[model samples]
Target: METAPVPAFSELISGTQRSAVHLEMRDVYDPGSRRFASWRSGHRENPANRDEWWNPFHSVIAEAVARGVQVRRARVVSEPVSDYVQFEYDVTFSNIAAGEQVRWLPRRRASDLALPGNDFWVFDGRLVRLSHFGGNGEFVQDEMTENPAVVKLCVEAFERVWERAVDHHDYRPA
Candidate 1:
C-alpha cells in the first residue's frame, strides 16, 4: 500500500465505528518537547484541573469516545523507565481523562510478542498509521496503510500487549 502524509487524528479516529487502538513501542518520544521540560522542573500539572491540562488532543479523544469509539492505547516500556517515558507517565492522566483506555507493559514481558517495527494506531481493524521516529525520539513520518497483512499484525500486536499490560491507574512508572 502507498503511504500518505499524516492525516488529522480526529478524522482518522472519527471515521471508525468500533475501535481505534494505539501501540507505542518507544521508551522515549520527542525528548525535546517543552512538556518534558515542565515535568523535569517539577511542574507537572494536576490532572483534576481540566482547565489547565485539557488540550485539542484531549478534545478529539473525548469527541470520538462520545460517539462510541473505543479508544485504547498500550505502551511497551523499559523497566526502570527512561526519563522520557516517565514524562509520558506524568501526562497520561489527560489521556485517561479524555476517555482513553491506557495501559503499560514492561519490555521484558513483551519478548515473545511479534510487534511491528514502529509505533502505530490501528483504526477499526481496517487501517493503520505507522508512526516513525528517529533514534533521538523526534518525529520522522507517518505512513498510513490499508494492507490487510500489516493491519492484522498490528491488531494482533496491540491485543497481545493490551492483554499483558497493567491499566494506567495501576501502573507506577517502573
Candidate 2:
C-alpha cells in the first residue's frame, strides 16, 4: 500500500507550538550536498554572508523562537568527528543565531540512552517527523507519526541526550 507524502520540515515546524526538539544521531549526512562540497574545499560559512547561506530552515527556527516556541537540537556524534560532522560544527553558529539551542553529544556518552534508530524532530511533545536516509546519506523519506508511545520514546531519548550534550558554543571538534 502506498503512504501519504511527508510534509516538508518547514511546514511541520510552521505548525508547531510550545516546543520543537531535533535529535540527530548521524555522523555523516548529505555527502553529495553542495554545501558539503564547499566545506570539503575549505570554504566556510561566514555569518556575515547571511544572504548567501540563510535558508528557510533557519528562518523557521527564528520565527518559532520569536513566537515563544523553544527550539532545540541535539546531535550524537562520534569523537574524532567525521569531516561532515566537523563541517556541521563549523557552521552551527548560524543555527544558534537562528535561535536554536544546539548541543553536541559524544557518541560514547549516549551508550546508556535508548535512542531511535533514525533521526527525528519532535514537535510540541506530540508529533514526530522521523527522517530516513539511504546508506550513502541521501534523503530517503520522512515518516510523520503522532503515536503517543512513539512520541514519548523520542521525547525521552532526546532529553537524555540533551542533558549530557555539550552546548554548541562550548563544543570543540575532537
TM-scores, all candidates, are: 0.96, 0.95
Of the candidates shown, which would achieve the greatest TM-score relative to the real structure? 1
Which residue pairs in candidate 2 have backbone atoms (N, alpha carbon, C) closer than 3 angstroms, thus clashing?
Answer: none
Clashing residue pairs found in predicted model 1: none
Q: Residues 72-118, candidate 2: write the lDDT tens digits.
A: 99999998999989999988988998999999999998898999999
lDDT of 1 by residue, 1-174 (tens): 676666888889878888999999898888777888888888979877899879898998899999899999999999899998898888898999999999999999999999999999999999999998999899998899988899999999999999999999899976
lDDT of each: 0.91, 0.90
Each candidate structure's count of clashing pairs = 0, 0
Question: How much lDDT does candidate 1 score?
Answer: 0.91
C-alpha lDDT (0 to 100) for residue 109 of candidate 2 = 89
Off by over 4 Å in 1: none
